[model samples]
Target: MKRNTNYYIRKAHRYLGLFLGIQFLFWTLGGLYFSWSDIDKIHGEHLVMEKKDFSTTSGLIAPDSILIKINSRQPLTPIAKIELVETLGEPYYQLQLMTGEYRLFSAKTGHLKPQFTKDEVIEIARTYITFEAEVKETELLTIVSNHHEYRERHLPVWAIAFDYEGDPVVYVDAVTGQFERIRHNSWRVFDWLWMMHTMDYETRDNFGNWLLKAFSILGLITVLSGFLLFGVSYNKREFKFLKIKKS
Candidate 1:
């Protein structure tokens, strides 16, 4: 019975390690990165520029006037929210309709500029970044790409790249002109590691994936079997200890 139990424990430990060893290493390394990596740097804090406060000075058009202008164009829909936002020192009325549509109207001229042009996007990127370099490349992405840092965000975004040290990239909402996400090399590495950790290649966000759960179970078995093997070996005097005779 002792031999049989020892053999089974040894087999379980060896095979389980073989099955889940790589995953275990990945979990360990990924966990270390997650624990030690600066979350702010991972979010591309050093890559992009900080947000400048909007001026709330006088001579700004009122929300009612903007609504009046919107009403003149077409019948009004139920608005979910309305707020004044300043972009590049220009005030605009950000209107969200109950139907889940967002509109941007110039607070000074009350003109609707919902979609931003390439130049406009570049300007927006510049406004948000501290650097003065021109946008190296700009692409309108209809679908989420693998390189995107924020995979769960809404699609139809503008990918603007800068010629900075880290090759920082910024994603902006195509329709709303909203700054969606920022990414750099560090963030890309972190994202890849996160994907491996979760074993969710498609979405990279599902922590409760079947593969991960299976590996976790196997890992637990490996640990428990290792402990059992050690206990068995100790009981059988397999581990040698140097003894000193009392004089």
Candidate 2:
């Protein structure tokens, strides 16, 4: 009876553990990947600058004068979608071209800087003009825009580390051209809470402690079994069996 029970226990443990093992492996690997990607962004030693409103507090330039200055440039084409607005105590303008829009601002001194240099601005204009002129061309940026969506979804995180001065982030509504703040939640205990939940972290009192330990043990067993399954060969014909790949 003892031997029989041991046999069944081992069998049940083996199968149950294997089932949990695959899921645990995926979870742990996914969590590690999340951490690694975040680390790269936070560890980088670059200071990011945001376009600041020197006009509001410093009294550098009046709003009306800035608009008149930019209008004089005449390099901006179409002139169909020039919009001027003041929001959150800052003044900015958006110029819509055939392709995408250009955002320009008046320097604190009331001098207008072309959103791009003369040459750079012309090249950007050319891309839009070419796209508009193409007889059969789908919008060239549609595909690129889709890829950007994927990036934001799959790796939807931005982080900045300590010791860097100046505004680390600039938030703007692409549609509205309004300056805003990007508020990031504090990654403190709440972050740890999530990390623990995803990683199966637990203390002795928590039921999750036993559950996670059991799952981890199962995961380790599964990895070992996988190696064993690959290593064990009953016959030469088993070469084909070992190579059966998973997509």
Candidate 3:
């Protein structure tokens, strides 16, 4: 019975190790990277420009002017919030409707500026960065390209790539003219590692997938079998030592 149990334990341990060893190594390496990597750097905070507070001083355009312009164009929706924001030193009135629609108007002229053109997006990208460089390329993404990084963000974004050292890319909301996120080489590598660690290829965030569960069970079996074999070996050696001492 002992020999039969040992045989089964050895077989299970060896096969489980063969099947899940590389994944174990990946989990360790990815975990170490996540633990040591600076979360701010991973978010590419160092590549983008900081937001400057909008001035609330006099000479600013009145809120009524913006409301009049918007109400004249279309039927009124219940307003949730209205605020003044500046991009590239130009002031604009951002209106949020309770229906989840956003509108932007030029605070100076009260003209409706719904969407940003490619030139305007490039200018915004340049203003968002501290360094001086023309936009290298601009691609309009109708849908989120990578769901892992840009999950839950609004669609129809502008991917503006810069000709900087790390080849930084900024994703801006085309409709709202908001800076969605910044991505670079480090972020890409970190994202790939995260996907591997989570083992969720489709979403890259689900941790309770079947593959992970199966592997976890196999890993537990491997560890328990190893401990059982160690205990068995220790007992056999001690039995032999006792017999020798008695003789």
Candidate 4:
């Protein structure tokens, strides 16, 4: 009976390890990097300006109306938020749409005015990276702000920084986005932990499926099997650190 039990256990361990071997290595490498590196910034926090020049009445106004007034020829795209500001005490509004910046105008008149733009928003994300100099680039003006709506999830605002070539480097938002406070995400390491475990940066389908559970079981088996294959007797050695003696 004991021999039969050992056989089944060994066989089970072997197959489980075989199935999970590659994934185990992936998890090991990813976990190692995540453990040592600052990998929590991948999913940034939401940022909203507290110094908004918005009154409750204006905030209630439809953002589409604001966008149409700014650029009568161009149509207003879907946006995450609308901001009203007083530049040098002059009232103008900013439309914080998906990626590009559009000026907001009075609903009654289609008047374009000098106001906040994308360049100004990016300066907000830069402050979190410890960048000291003011970042003013027209190329970055084309950057698209990323907005994720979870509906019931209360997702934060995220602003991405683009290089001279308009490539992304980092993200920030109010809880982390632009023109808002700088809050790092190291405290929420699980976001990176999830990415490291699944190698899925753009999706969440990796967690909670039967495949992941099965693979986790296999990983556990693989770890045990390798140790068993070594035949390092626990009875003979008090601790593996102690050298064995030959009779």
| Predicted model with the maximum TM-score | 1
lDDT of 3: 0.81
For candidate 3, the 10 contiguous residues with the lowest summed lDDT are 143-152
Question: For candidate 1, what is the lDDT?
Answer: 0.80
Candidate order (TM-score): 1, 3, 4, 2
Cα deviation of 142, candidate 2, in Å: 15
Residue 222 displacement in candidate 3 (angstroms): 2.2
Off by over 4 Å in 1: 132-134, 145-147, 238-247
**In candidate 3, which residue pairs clash?**
none
C-alpha lDDT of residue 87 in model 1? 73
Per-residue lDDT of model 1, residues 190-217, tens digit only: 8888888999888888888898898788
lDDT for position 54 in model 2: 32
- What lDDT is reached at residue 213 by model 2? 72
lDDT of 2 at 191: 35
Q: Between candidates 3 and 4, which one is better according to lDDT?
A: 3
lDDT values for all models: 0.80, 0.41, 0.81, 0.47
List per-candidate RMSD values in Å: 2.9, 17.2, 2.7, 9.2
- Which 10 successive residues of model 2 have the least lDDT summed? 134-143
